[model samples]
Target: MTGPVRHLHLTELRARVLSEDPAALEAWEALTNHLANVKRAREKGPRGFEKYYEACRQGLHRLSLLAGIKGISLYTSRHQFAADSKRAGHSHPQTAAEMGHASDRTAVTHYGRRVQGRPGTPLPLPSPEEVKTVRKKLGPSNGPHREQK
Candidate 1:
């Protein structure tokens, strides 16, 4: 397997969806095509990228939409927030708090509750019954094949 794909930039993203310029390089075209397969068009769905559950190639590209909306790449925002918080002297305690919460398996639960009120995060986590139903549908053979053979 290869490394985690580095996210793309706004200019790279724009050059992709709006591939009208003929002077664009071959590398750009290749990268854009790869993105097209991984990242669904914004016109398609709101997730920015659809997560495929199979091979590594079948992955999501959430940064595209996030960068577009935030007017800055996710990494930049992450760094910016860290820098700001550090300057404000709130970074250490905040990081520790987040780390403490990280161990809680109720991870997305709190997150979902927050945005459940908004149009965002419409689908809350599946209930136990819902999970059972999905398991029955897939059957044991169709389970995630992550075991070392």
Candidate 2:
């Protein structure tokens, strides 16, 4: 098979792929062998990328089931990973790049949650008096502008 190529600097993942470690090397070999079998299956049939993707999804589902983890899906795992990365003190741009987001905004808006306070805590609204005072300060300009007669 081919030598391991450097993709990212994930220390744990990298350690598991290097040939210097016998157990890790064996695990990597088994993974590569399985992938090769999948590639051979693709070459022998009309199955393409979609089939490979579905197979991966099925495998993940089976693993989750075996682990007794309920409500874990691909999307949920992605969201969790993004949140975990953020919590681990990674910057927005760094997390976005790692997650393959087009921009940092995507990572913040979709994956990241508000860091302050408890999640789902209702924000306090302005009191009636406060609302009236603000409205009074705004005056007649609150509505759409009208042409002066």
Candidate 3:
């Protein structure tokens, strides 16, 4: 649900429902929209919504088992989405926004694996002597007693 549900998924569901009865579009749409309980359930509480979500998850698991698919779950799907986004030449920030991440760092750290052996420029580090020279120049004049003097 993070990304748009695959069109194939919707197509398959529509096919399955129509196979049972040709005139089930309204019924299918009702189910898809959860219109049956939408208004009434809001007044009741979120327990009904939670129960529906769990049932859908269980159904997905059962369907995966029936199809002989292993290791297909929400996490794997999300990981694949992130990996695919990276492969498609999207920047970390773009991928992060598409995947609903708050920060690009999360996308980079978790999903953006750097290509090994890629050459890059290294940042220059100042030498110890340079640091000491800077400290000496900034030290005595900036000291507390200098203000009094």
Q: What lDDT does each candidate get?
A: 0.32, 0.50, 0.47
lDDT of 3 at 72: 66
Summed over model 3, clashes come to 0
lDDT by residue (1-149, candidate 3, tens digit) is 33321111245446656787544566577666775654455556757656766665787789899999977664655565555555544444444454555455555456523331112211112233322322122122221111111
Winner by lDDT: 2
Give the better candidate number (1 or 3) by TM-score: 3
Better of 2 and 3 by lDDT: 2
Q: Flag regions of model 2 displaced more than 4 Å.
A: 1-7, 11-47, 66-68, 112-149
> Any idea what lDDT model 1 has?
0.32
Q: TM-score for every candidate vs. truth?
A: 0.20, 0.47, 0.43
The window of 10 residues in a row where model 3 has the poorest summed lDDT is 140-149
Ten residues in sequence with the least summed lDDT for candidate 1:
115-124
lDDT of 2 by residue, 34-115 (tens): 7797777678677664577577788888989999997767677567656655555554555445565434555555763534
